[model samples]
Target: MSQSPGILMMVIAFVLALGPLVFLHELGHYLAGRWFGVKAEVFSVGFGREIGGFTDKRGTRWKFGMLPLGGYVRFAGDMNPGSQPDPNWLALPAAERARTFQAKPLWQRAIIVAAGPIANFLVAIVILGAFAAAYGTITIPPVAGPIKAGTPAATAGLREGDRILSIGGREFDNFNDMAAFTSMRAGMRVEIDYVRDGQQARTETVIGQDVSKDRFGNEVRRGVLGIAAPAEIVRSTVPVWQAPIVGVERTFSLVGMMVDGLGQLIAGRVPVSELGGPMRIAKMSGESLSLGFESFVVFVALISINLGFINLLPVPMLDGGHLLFYAIEGVRRRPVEPQVMEWAFRGGLVAILALMVLVTFNDLGAFGVWRNLAGLIG
Candidate 1:
């Protein structure tokens, strides 16, 4: 295995990669709020105590916080960074109320909230489009090469030159998609459909497992199909004008995969240990940086898509949570009772915190932090 990047390099890479993405996310909210004539009280990158900032002419205090995990934009009449309306919003002077976020129409509020995620998606599209324009899109045929004896594929009567059609009902456009689908399903039984010599066949087999160690000595496990097929490289030069279209298509494709992965996790088919947090991201960022500029850029685009997708989940204390409330208000033709909103936000906060703790614990285990500490103690 290759050596891991230095600790300092990992920290630097984490900051360099996540900082701009967070800023852009918050900027989307800020710009949309401003467009709706809502006054932004604070535009902050990161969380917790402010490190340094300056008040802009529009009274938006642009600041960096001590914790670099995430960020937010607090608009006028917001009770907190979560964008909850102030309880006393109606009591504000007429002029002040007009410039407050709560005073905006429901549709405008929804747009402002949704803009953050949309911005993230746009970032992914632009980066991917640039790559497609420069290097073209690549695709590989989903054909089995060599089936290892005694493995699941071999046991299921799979043979070389079989064209894979789908696994577990999910059709694949290419071999990469098939590989991705299998990699997350270690130890899970899956039905495979394929065409062999112009005849269709189906087989059920458990995905095989491969366990190894990264440079950091952390155990890595992945599902394999026991096929030793080298990916047939097929590159198509995308016209510069059509690059964005390719990017958009690929972006949606990735989102679909993510949805499937999420469903798998929820159904208990994928282990919770597979989930990760900031530390995992930092590790991957450093590793990608070590690989090359192109690898790092791709990593950034993937993370951007993740950030967008996650923020759109209808959980409280997030942009999606806010949008959810706006949606409710739109249907009801009035805001939800303040008490109900408060409890919902509280529940959302608890959920978000719990997720953070869970993913962080998973990260610690993945990095062998707990095991190393036990070694020191023992």
Candidate 2:
């Protein structure tokens, strides 16, 4: 087993991986707000007290905060980092009020709020595309190479040389797609379609699962089909012109996986202990860094996608929450009542804080902090 990276390395890796992504996310919001004539009062990476900063020519105070978890852009007329509207800003003269975020048209406000997450998605796409362009894409046919006896695939009547057509109604483009899909569906029964000797057939089997730990000692649980990849592999160099298209397709594929994972979590098919916070991210970042530069860059891209997807969740205090509010206002042709919005935001904040605590606790447990403490006490 490989040893985990030291604590200092983990912290440095976390900062390196998260800092630029957070900055880009906020930059997306700031640029969009400025485009609509909104004056950005502050552009800070992270939260809480300002550690170091300077005012830009546009009067935007660019700063770093004490906490290095996430970032925000406070536009004019915003009461706080959450972008709540300030009633006091309403008293501003016409010229100044016009430059406030809240004073912008409803559509513009929605765009500004959405830009942050969109930026993260774009970053993932660009990175993935660049990788494809550089090293090309490798694909394997979704044909069973060897079926281990008594495994899910074997039990499902699958045989060697059988070509997989689909699983759980999703068509397979490559063996990797099939493997990735099955890996996340552990213990769930799903329909599998394949062709044997030019004849199509279908069967259902419960996906087998394996639980193990990575080199860093983090637990990993994955569904196993007990069918190996075919011997033949194909690699194709992606054209520079088509890289972006490949990027978009790959990005959406990842988003789909995220949706599937979230659904599993909600359905209780997966343990809530799988939820991770900053500590898990830091560990993964350090481990990826130790592997090599390419692995580290890919890890960053994956995190970028996660950041984008999570922000789009309809939970309050997220970019998605703001979009939800804007959607309601659009239909009603009026903003949600201030008191109602306030209460909703408060509730959202509480929910967010609770989730953070839960994930942090899970992280500590995964790291053996609780176990070590118990050993010492005993």
Candidate 3:
């Protein structure tokens, strides 16, 4: 695994992470619509050419599409792909109109629209917490666990149970501190300090630069000891039991950060080009796969939360956008004029498409294609 090619890793991670999350997201909307007595016509994991499909007892054609990027759920009267409604269908008998999305109670409509992203967040929280509870966290205290026999650390006479006092002569306490130092000084020479057999010892070695791509498909250089994670997993009866709570807290913390970052991007303090689209996300999924299944699962959950949060934003053309219209209708006790709604929807549609383009450009930059293109042009 240490010698695995970086490119191959990026490819696998992208699919594993995004594919399931998307399907689950669509499922949320599908289930909610059903709950509200709105039947689904089609449930697809992607758009366009059909890879595979089946008609369920309910007559819903469930299938996987060719693109494998984005997905959608088509409701019974969703003549429009967006599932808002068709006015011509609404012009039919009152009973027919009742089945339409717009005709449903405002609360039900809101739930159906909000369901997609909500599922994403729930999946993330459960997956992360369950994983932590299942696999007791590893406490990589400064103590030596196992050093690869042929690695530099092993050759330097380091032994099991030796407590690492410092690396690169800088005092370090836990794995986090060591990681911080190693990252800042990857591929550089350093001296390791450890207490072995109750005696302090120092060994000189150079940290290896791991030329790897992160889950996001961005090239990252990190310090490596050419060692594998140890088998000494700590089972914290008390701490492990609280994994769910901690996991939710952690997820919320991340959400807060993303919200802050998006706020900055909107404020123009952060570059819109820094926003990543699906391309970058898939690439990242591939990279995360290389780290290990645990790490990959954690990332998958995070992406789910991100999907949930992103969809909740009150922007048109999105699930949240429909909810916005519903809110406006509720406030005024009537639907906004069709012409006015169309204009606003179009404006929002343009904004979303523009943002998509910007993010795709960022994804290209993240994958280093932008740099390659720049070099070629020059």
State every prediction's TM-score relative to the real structure.
0.95, 0.97, 0.70
1 or 2, which is superior by lDDT? 2
Top-lDDT structure, candidate number: 2
lDDT of 3: 0.75
Better-scoring candidate (lDDT), 1 or 3: 1
Give candidate 1 regions above 4 Å deviation. Answer: 215-218
lDDT (CA) for every model shown?
0.89, 0.91, 0.75
**Each prediction's Cα RMSD?**
1.8, 1.3, 9.2
The Cα error of candidate 2 at residue 88, in Å, is 2.1
Best by TM-score: 2
lDDT of 1 by residue, 149-248 (tens): 9888998889998999999898977888888888888888899999989999999999998888876666777888887664576889999999899899
Winner by TM-score between candidate 3 and candidate 2: 2
- Candidate 3 wrong stretches, greater than 4 Å: 1-9, 91-97, 135-241
Per-residue CA lDDT of model 3 for 1-378, tens digit only, reads: 123336666666777788899999999999998888887878999888999999999889999999887899987666553454675875678876666666678889889988999899889878877876786545556667777776666767777777788886677555544664555454567788888788988887777656775334445655666444444545464266698786786578668767755764566544456578987776666656766788788889889988888888888777888888889989999877777767777888899899888888888887678799899999
